[model samples]
Target: MTLRSGAVTALLTATLIASTAATAASTPAAPRGEGAGVLRVSTSTPLTTAARLQAAGFDLVESRIGTDLLVVGDAAVRSRLGRMGYRVTVQQTAPTTERPVSTGRTNGIAAAAATFYGGYLTADEYVQHLSDVAAAHPDLAVTRDVGDSWRKTQGLATGNDLVAICLTKLQPGDCQLTPTSTKPRFLLIGAVHARELSATELSNRFVDLLANGYGTDAEVTSLLDSTEVWVVPVGNPDGREIVEQGTTSPYLQRKNANNSLGACAVPPTSSNQHGVDLNRNFTWKWGGTGTSTNPCDQTFRGSSAGSEPETVALSQLMTTLYPDQRGPLATDAAPLTTPGYMLTLHSYANMHVIPWGDTTTKAPNDAGLRSAAFRASYYNGYQTGQPGQILYTVTGSTDDYLYGERGVAASTMEVGPNSGSCTGFTPAYSCQDGFWTANKPAMMYLAKAARAPYQLSLGPTTTSVTAPTTTVTAGTTFTLTATGNDNAYGTSGVGKPTAQTVNAGRYFVDTAPWNGGTAVAMTANDGSWNSTSEVAKATVPTAGLTAGKHQLWVQTRDSSGNWGPATSAFVTVG
Candidate 1:
């Protein structure tokens, strides 16, 4: 959900109304109404009505297929929808106009949190945090200037650099801006729509999790050693600065600071604002459904495809980091060996949106995409589908461009629930930790799935690998246990995939099977692998092993012969 309109002053109120009506000709105007809030509108044709509302510049929140829409707007919006013959119900009113003051803790996580808002991070703070993380963990993280923001390119004083941080074990060619790399890449882009505060904060936490948990956490250690995780926090820094500058309330700025065309209001309101919607300014499926030609509208597609500097820079970065794996046809599917995965975070939409967002038509690799989305959504409990099937038809989104143009496996994760303290565009600061805890496992799953997304996503998952003790003496035998499940896919939304039986399981000591480690058979605890869930165990012989920490990698295979992603447990042979 992008914009929420409100009156700034008595004098400019009329002008704002006129501007909104003039720009949004498709939208009907009603008498001036008080109070701005969220609305749940019931409609028999949800998909059609969703697209209609989007085209009319309504702030349509993400909703499940065949369900009533959740919209954020004022009384006029309600009246207009009423005239259009829809039943609208107010969900909740906007918070008070008084901004919540921050305590301003200068050390640790509080420092990165927003000064005015307690949980969210400002654009400048996010950039500083990236630099601080890189400085504190040089061996595991490096920050790069991907491109310049719109204001920066315009030589404005308040501009910022489009920065990205890559986290991995720094090998010779690691983190370089090259398509060829020694390890697979998982790129997480956040806050492309600047008002989505939780997106940026989530990215920040992900960086912290991987960079700080390197050696101590077995999963994080194995992931960083085998994959390059990239984070582009605060993608629209200029607009984010405007959002940070909000005094009375947070500015719902959803676009870049390229106020070159329209006579938009100063200190942008929810409805009338100048700038291109960065998410809608991509080259693929540009200027289509769910986008507006009006510069004042929230979903304003730029003057041309990839017109915004931020959009161009992001596309260029993806091209540099990921090779084109699919053919030029719309029906062509990327191979199962595709090496990169991408997730763009948005707000107020509890959805894991797959590619081909502009239409309900499934992508060429819909099976793999849905499987991966379902697997990730298992942690977050989000609905998974194409944007048209889940929320509304969105064109020129980053996920669509990355998947359609560059052949990368990409999806958009709309964070936060529809209702609660953690809901809405600017959720309460206290909601950050809860959201992070809920999303961490899902993010980790997607990061690990980047290795072979199409193939690994189809197999059973090795949920856990455990030993009775992490430390053991030399020339000793220890039992290793693991839990494998083929039914780990999420069933919260449309297209619930069928689960397969876990037919086989194996464990490898000291090395991964791909690295020529010998596989040791693990017998099922229940004496058979006839069900979707299985518990397997094995005894490892450490007689010939050297005295040091060794990784025990465990993997499971489904009855269909698909090998899932590996889970590692460390055993110290001291």
Candidate 2:
């Protein structure tokens, strides 16, 4: 997400690091203890180099082929690599420092808006906050305990239960996983990487705004009435607790607390020995090019696809909310009929990346995904594209898993510090304003867009039908006319080529006795519609009718994959 400032300098640095590549070192047993200090290691390829570093038990700070890795390890790391013939350079000698926790938050409703900017909250505080809102507004907010985090499952005091909050006026099956109703859905997940604290804060604030603004805000009320906004504010509670432990200068823990993988040879011990990168643990493209086998490494794919508890739970939640809206393979684009959208927030990179992160291959629904991301970026000003196109290749990521495997329209929003005044991983509490202010509109757009995420918002109605009389003789031919507009017009992020045109319609006729009819495509020009409200006509042949009365039905499908509301015209045969 952070494009290195000096391209030439970065390339030279990366080359210097790669040149030191030596013979593959023998795999060492899990470190008996942690190592310290910082080292810069480089590889010819970003993805492969990262895999090497992680596999070697190095705690990576940041990495890319263009930007040599910044890692944490002691002199033994240097010695081992020296023996292996790989070049290693000392970047810094000091231990990583923590950011001091801010003491400004009150966690009270009166100051709810201020709480988001105050500081990051503890896992318990987050749970309490969700409960508080649900308690205060029973009709508008509700919380569900989805599952227990890894730490909780381990019987540790630091572990916490996973929770999801639904902010909509409740009705039958409103928040349940069952897809029984007609309402559209938007799912927002935050803090999957424990170090990205702002994600959680932003999610919490969104929950607060929606639950509190119910009747007071017209737009919010209408949105809730028609759509469901589900938020999982803390997606990785075990890892979050580790990061929270170092409140003074929050500990940097990128993965969960599943210590089955032993500690890295890096200091600040606890995080190194445990956890899988929940982001890389998803089933789709799991264990592909940009992941690791070393459990101690930051981007380690778990023992198997969907291996981690966090991964399993979140994936289950997503499936529970949305059916596989797209076809089973890569060529199958999500049906325009699908009505789900997902956004998972991360930080330190001011970018909104579309799916297909597993490789450079474009998704079948790439057009819709790119269009939505570009439109969403208008409000936040974040660069948008498939991750492999804009950023580096990342396998088994949440967005890719959601979109590729489940056929949901999904993206990852890297929340803060695009460039100027870069705050890096944990930006100060004061910097929250810049993020929230810029993202408000984009977030709201996502909520409204859920109504028809994959479809163009166009509906056609039958305007008129002409025939000889109400009792037209059998074998008589007549015409039916109807009009429709691209309802998406004038809406922000809408009306692009993808959302502005209607393509075809299925036109059908039923005889006087109302014989069960098989529908067929409308013939010729009748099948196509254009303009804001253009009239489309269908010529009907009553050759097979039994006389008496008959009915005509027309339903149009827009170019953007939406089926317009059905329109009907009645005619009689004598």
TM-scores, each model vs. reference: 0.91, 0.67
* lDDT of each residue in 477-508, candidate 1, tens digit only: 99888988888977776686799999899999
- lDDT values, one for every candidate: 0.82, 0.65
Across residues 281-304, which tens digit of lDDT does each residue of candidate 2 receive? 899888885677877766778899
Best by lDDT: 1
Best by TM-score: 1
For each candidate in turn, give its C-alpha RMSD to the true structure in angstroms: 4.9, 13.8
True lDDT of residue 534, candidate 2? 49
Once superposed on the true structure, which residue ranges of model 2 sit more than 4 Å away at CA?
Answer: 1-118, 264-273, 456-574
